[model samples]
Target: MIGFSILNTINTDNDDLSGLNEIPFTVSYVTSIHRAQGLEYKNVKLVITDDDKTNMTHDIFYTAITRAKENLEIFWNAETQKFVIDNFEEQTQKWNKEIALINAIKNNK
Candidate 1:
């Protein structure tokens, strides 16, 4: 596996190349959802494996889907499909309850 690391340089001059000691190399196209946070891409391809689903959360799934600016594709098995459905339903119910409470408060005022 190829790993990439970030280098911090204190020099402000663009002509100072002495700070760079290592040769430039390419990085993998794949990245974790956590690492991709606050970043947008023209296209995104997401793959969900059984191991991934074990640690998957609603927020992570949402973040993955929203990463794509123009197009997004997802690949998963039936088990993962069921898990996504259940998670969506749970989130929907939670939002509905919150909205109801807000409406009730407004009526009581």
Candidate 2:
């Protein structure tokens, strides 16, 4: 009954679960945002799913917004036309930084 964490944000083709199977303790691959609820990690990595302003009111978005106990990291794909990253702990991390950065770069003259 021990807890170890490795937050993976690479949305690659490899079976991300492969490495988890070797660990002695439980290896829970909460791939979908729905499955990630009620979980927290010292190192949190959120893989940005294909969601955005057009389809923002999503359960996956809700689930992804609330799974962090400490540090949180995110991954957004290049193909995405619109993606919004939400941090439930807004008071702590100040969620607007990434969006600001993106907008600034996109609008640079």
Task: Give each model a TM-score.
Answer: 0.57, 0.35
lDDT of 2 by residue, 1-109 (tens): 5666554556677756644522348554555555667776565666655654334444555566567667677676755424343333342254378777789999995
Report the Cα lDDT for candidate 2.
0.57
Question: Which lDDT values do the candidates have, in the order given?
Answer: 0.83, 0.57
Q: In model 1, which runs have C-alpha deviations exceeding 4 angstroms?
A: 1-27, 54-58
* Weakest ten-residue segment in model 1 by summed lDDT: 1-10
lDDT per residue, candidate 1, 1-109, as tens digits? 4444444577565765555554456454999999999999988999998777766778898899999999999999999989877877788899999999999999999
Off by over 4 Å in 2: 1-30, 49-57, 78-109
